[model samples]
Target chain A: MEEQVLIAGFGGQGVLSLGKILCFAGMKKDYNVSWLPSYGPEVRGGTANCQVIVSDQEIASPMFEASTAMLIFNEPSLHKFEEWARPGSAILLNASLIASPLTRQDVRAYYVPASELAEQAGSLQCLNIVMLGAYVAACHTVDEETVQAVLTETFGAKGEAVLQMNLRALDLGKTYIQTQK
Target chain B: MAKILMKGAEAIAEAAIEAGCQAYFGYPITPQNEVPEYFAKRMPKLGRTFLQAESELASINMVYGAASAGVRVMTSSSSPGIALMQEGISYLAASRLPCVIANFMRGGPGLGGIQPSQADYFQATRGGGNGDYYLVVYAPATLQEMCDLTKEAFDVAEQYRLPVMILADGTLGQMMEPVELGNYVPRTKADMTWAATGFQGGKPRSIINSLYIQPEELEERCLAMFDTYREIQAHEIRVEEFHVEGAQLIVGAYGTMARIVKSVIMQLDQAGGPKVGLVRPITLWPFPQEAFAKAAAQESVQAVLSVEMSMGQMVEDIRLAVNGRKPVSFFGRTGGMIPTAKEVREQILALCNGGKE
Candidate 1:
């Protein structure tokens, strides 16, 4: 299956990192993957975005005009990308920062207080990880087990305690979706 | 070796190292600064020479110096920076110094923008500097191809004693992809007779200079260089064809635009659109004129579309290659704007429907 995802937020919000991790996770599973960022002139606190494609076959174009999934972390990201969503696509909305509700009826929308949930579970810096967990739980783009393994491998060098906290943040996000279900 | 995920810039840097390029000199430019950043940290560890020159001119000249000393040396830049290096590039070409030069092209006639563009097609394939010179230009469609071609570039330059250029755009330089870096057979440059490595009681002496004031002597030198160019054209033309068997419409694209055009072709194929195909020129300089001629002369081909990221630069070569065998058209997006696959497919569909776009 080919999965094209767009993740967008403020520059310091770890949006690019979220996309990078997903790319690494997809690659670890031997899938063809590409991560393309919207760079140049973007600064801290400015809008940051990236497109990640994971496919079983060769990925022809990494730049996606429309995406199968989107993670909207702020209002500007939602306003910018909501109309570009393909039909039946999933949009994971971070309710903590975005006050307005998603009005798109064609695509599925999952609302999670990502920053609040991450703060409660560990730290607000893990906000992206929380949303990533919720998105993975909602749609099985990549296996949650594989994501966990990737996270462990990625964060292992920091320290055991830091890794556990981030893992807990991801689990909290997954549990948040399960409770809603 | 297992495949590792790497950005195109880093991959190019590592690939050069793998190819035994012992010297790198460059000045930083946006969308490709990572190349120098990578080499600065890695080259020291590898016991190679890495210098961040004060200017692009200085950087290219430094490469000239190292390459004249018979070491595999390279330099990279974006469009404006590359413009500054044109004098040095011409000198290297005239002096028959083998070196690799990479241009991660951004939008330009002059610092147009820091995004991707193929506007430099004319500058790359044609000589950016004055006089008649040709750099064997390789346009990679994917990051893996970029790495592979970069490794092969060193050998091609050495074998031909000519400058080889990896003419990539900002998109390919910035994107990340999984790359399988296989082992490269190391090339030793110890016994190069033409190299200016000091007359160590060997032969007599070697001189590397591009200035021959005598008109007749300069004409002879240029004719000799043209001989090398002719040999390269005869032997080293590379193109990748897709679905060209009975295609009515043939799309000729290169670099990032080729990848996007391929996507459009795939969609058209799936939706039972016209019999379309693509002819991707992997080597832009040795323009693959013969392949274009064959495809355009096919009984089924009615039109040839040349898509680029410029206001139609490479289309001229396409027209020449087609030689009026079929109608050649141009499609492009300039000033750092990338055309979508859907838009290209729509254009193709319009053409299929006999509507001019």
Candidate 2:
């Protein structure tokens, strides 16, 4: 199965790193994956988005016409990428930041209060990771084990405390998704 | 072996280091700044030299100096920055220095937006620097190919004794994908007999100069360079063909644009509309005319479409290669805008309808 995901938020919301972590998770599973970040002026303080494609086959263009899944962390990201979702695609939104509901009826969407959950879990910086947890739980693109392994690999240098906090943040998001359904 | 996920820019940097390139000199430029950043963090650790030159000119000249001393050296920049280094590039070409230059091209004309663009086609394939010279240009379509070609680039540069260029737009430089990193075998530079090390003992002094004031002597040097270019053209032409069997139309593209075309070809294959194929030129300078000719020679092939990210820069070469055997048409998106697969397919379908311009 192929999943084209767009993870979007403001510049400092860890959008790019979340996409990279997703790519690493997919790679650990031996899937063909690509992560393309919006570089240049758009990434300064404005809405920054990254397109992540994970497939069993070769990924052609990193930029997809319509994404299979989207994780929006803020209102701007929702407005920017909501229309680009493919029919029946899954869109996970941060309900804490985005007050609007989905307009499109064709796709499945989950309102995961990612920012509030991450903030409660310890820090608001793990907001993207929380959204990533929701997407992974919904799509099952990669196993939670794979995500945790990559998280350890990525955050290992930051020491045990930071790594455990982020891991807890992920589990908190995953638990929230499970409770919702 | 398992592959590792890497960004395109960082992959190129790693590939260069793995190829035993010892020195990197470049100014920071958008869309390609990661190249120097990667080297800056890694090269010092590896004991290799990494210098962020004050400007592109100084960078290229530093590359020239390191290369003249028989060290594997490289410098990378985007469009406007590369334009600044053209004079130094010309001198490097004239002096027969072996070095690699990576151009992660962005939108062009002058100081255009820092987005992906293949608009530097002419500036890259045809010498931007004055006089008779050619940079052996390699345009990689995938990040894997980007790493592989970069490793091969250093070898080709030293073998041909000329400056080689990796002609990538910002798309290839910024994107991340799976890359099977190649092993690094330490390069021994013992065979650099002509390098300007020193004239110790009774050894004769070696002079490296591009300036020959006498017209005839300069012409002679150019003719000799042309001989090398001809040899390179004969042996170094590389192209990748996809779905060419019984194809009624051929889509010609390079770099990231070629990947987009490949997706279009896959779409047509699934729809079973027309027999379509792609001819991806890996080596742009040695323009694979033979491959184009062979693809055009297919009995079912009706026309060839040259798809680029520039305003018909490579179409001229496509027309020359097709040589009126088939109607050669052009489709492109300029100024860092990339044409989607759907839009490109529409163009291809229109071309197949009547094989018109």
Candidate 3:
């Protein structure tokens, strides 16, 4: 199986870290993975994006024009990448920030209130993690336990309180998607 | 060692350390800053030298100094910064210093955008420095290859006592992938007898200088270096071939562009389009001339295409390699613009249908 995901948002919105964690999880599952970030001036408070490829076979190119899935966190990101989504692909957008609806009709779109979900879960910082949980639930690219393990490894140093907060955010997202279905 | 996720720049630095890099002297440059950053953090902990030189000029000269002492040394920069070090690079080559220089190239004939680009093709392979000299240039397409070739670059540089370059771009430098950073086997400096270690009583002092006052002596020195270059060309030509047999079109690219072309080939093959092959030059210099000549000679191959991130730099080399055996065409995106797979596929399809442009 192969999945190419493009994640885009504002600079401080954890867009790059979200992609990194996704790739790390892919690596843990014995899959080949690559992450390419958009660097330079554009990443400083401007829109930031990263392309990630996770495949069962060796990946040829880290950058591609189209993606099988996209996680857009802002309106600009939605506008920038909506056309690049492949037919029958999945798009998970942050409903809290991106009020405009998706333009493409060939793909599946998931409107997750990531910021609101994170706010409800205790902090707005876990919005990206909330989107990750939504992506896992909707696309099933990876398992929840694997993501949890990654979160533990990533946030474990910050102590149990922060870890629990992130865990709750993940569950909130996943449960939101589950209840929707 | 198990594979771990690493950025291309960071992985290269780690690989250099594993290959026994004793000193790192470099100035910060975009698309390649992480290289020195990684070295700065890790070098001191390992009791190695990591100096952030004032400029690219100082960095390369520092590299020359450390290398003359028979230590594994390296420096990295982007296109503009590399341009500033051309004089020192030439001197290092003339003095026969073994050092590794990595160019994570970005767009430029000048201070261009900080994006992935292979525009430094000519500057690297043809020598940006004055005089006739060659650097063993490796253009790696993947992070794994980046690490492996980085480790090998040091050995190759030491073996020939010439500078070696790892020609990469910002995409590869910034990208992250799983890599196995092989074991750290300390490189032996025993063979570096020519190093300027210090004078000993009754022993000839080793001198490291690029100057030869007499024209005849300079000519002799250059000819001797050419002999080493010829030896390197004979032994160290690396190329990878994919679906070359009975293919109608063959695309030639290197580094990041090569990977993108590979993806295009795979897509076309899956869709039952015209049979396309790839001839990727792992070593940019010692430019796999024979491989292209052989690929162009195939009866099924009608034309050759050179894909790059530059306007058309590597195309000249491809044409020289093909030598009228096939109609060679060029397609590229310059100034930090990366060509997509769709665009490459369209180029190949146009070639297949229109037959030679």
Candidate 4:
């Protein structure tokens, strides 16, 4: 039950936000989880990332030896983490991201047109959701229901519409992955 | 008691609030910025004093002013910032002001990258700021220890009329885990008495300056401070020993890196005393020197391995603590390239086999 997830992309692509969401969602689901971000200059408009781990046992170190799955919102991340993935590891690539599909196929690779799908969903801001949906599909550590409950709790009193839209994006992702499978 | 996951920097800020700290002076630095942020958002709402100074120099001086006013005060920074605060730190040491300073160490010499590093070992245990006074320094590897030790640092500061430090790394600051928020019994504001509250009728005016006219008097004061330091070393040397009995190797570590070493000890034990042991120095300043020395004296101990985010800072102390009685070895991954327990085990095994490493 040791699931290591990496979310990587450009700085403003909500990489930090997505990682936090998943880390917190795991906590809500009562799992031992941790979120470690790339600190220092690795954050300003350049490559940014965070490692989120959910395990039934105590996390020895907040680092991952083999990232079980990744949500790459850009080409660099795809190229960077692709070499490190183990067999059967998932690489959910956003075709609309900075990088396209040049990744080698020794693992489960999915081409998620997440950016365009997000724009069509009436909110480009929800691209993170599309990628997160891929993560959910690949990892299945937490259900969509749990994610929604966390969103409702996180969005506070004024988050009703946000909660709905985010859920929509998530479902859109589920449908997108479902067709591929 | 309850449980919650807390970062070392966040715990320092929260502990400041609980310790009745009237002011928190600080500047932004990696791995340690959470302390200021936590205070910035919460202190104002709580009606406590909070200031984000322009530089570490300004922050430390602000701490000086706040402390002089007979109020609980705190400031935190990384190695560079601590270097900037050295002058003021020396003054605080000399004046015997009670305050807490947290060092979220990153790799360094100059403008080091933002990652966990214990390279400040010499600077910390030996007094980086300079002067003869000793600070009661605490090195917490866990979030729980960070919070608990922070509050305890304040108490030690006031009790001994000295400065205390929470020496942690960025890993402890940016990581999240389940932590217990148990029954928090904050120390009462009235519990501490050596403050600079203005003198009342008939009460003599209290001075908090570090100036003394007589050289002999100053010397006496210095001697007394050393005596206090020795007493603290004797009474407060805390260490967490793991898998030591009948163990072949002992890895000495502290702070965030120590947790990884803890995991390594478990792995070694499972690998048949790959018979490895651990000595966690929770108090980096006082250091668990006596414990390690005693352990090293045993023939089965073989060699001591020092693991840290720095190249090899704490290793020097380990060697000295062992006093050449045992062969001390070092292995590290700095610049944020921390190694796993397996790597450490490989290094230790190489050493014990008398092979090139």
Index of the highest-lDDT prediction: 3
Error of 2 at A118 (Å): 0.9
Model 2 DockQ reads 0.78
Q: Write the per-residue lDDT of candidate 2 for residues A1-181, one digit (tens) a residue.
A: 8899999988899999999999999888888899988987874568888999999988877778899999988898888889999999999999998999999899999999888889877899888888878887888999899999998998899999888878988898888888889
B1-357 in candidate 3: lDDT tens per residue? Answer: 889999999999999999989999999999989999999999999999999999999999999999998999999999999999999999999999999999999998789889889999999999999998999999999988999999989989998899999999999899999999876444454378899887766557889999899999999999999999999889999999999889999899999899899988888888888999999999989899999999989999999999999999989999999999899999999999999888898899999987543
lDDT of 4: 0.79
lDDT of 3 by residue, A19-138 (tens): 999998998899999999989887456999999999998799888788999999999888888999999999999999988898788999899999999999989999999999999999
User: Which is better, 1 or 3, measured by DockQ?
Assistant: 3
Docking class of 4: acceptable
lDDT of 1 by residue, B136-179 (tens): 99999999999989998999898889899999999988999989
Ranking of predictions according to lDDT:
3, 1, 2, 4
Task: Judging by lDDT, tell me the better candidate of 1 and 4.
Answer: 1
**Measured by C-alpha RMSD in angstroms, how accurate is candidate 4?**
2.6
Per residue, candidate 4 scores C-alpha lDDT tens digits across B107-210 of 78788778778788878788877668678889987777787788777777776778888888888888766665543565444344456676666565667778
Better of 1 and 2 by TM-score: 1
lDDT of 4 at B292: 88
Show the colliding residue pairs in model 1.
none
lDDT of 3 at B176: 96
Q: If the candidates were sorted by their TM-score against the true structure, best first, what order would they fall in? A: 1, 3, 2, 4
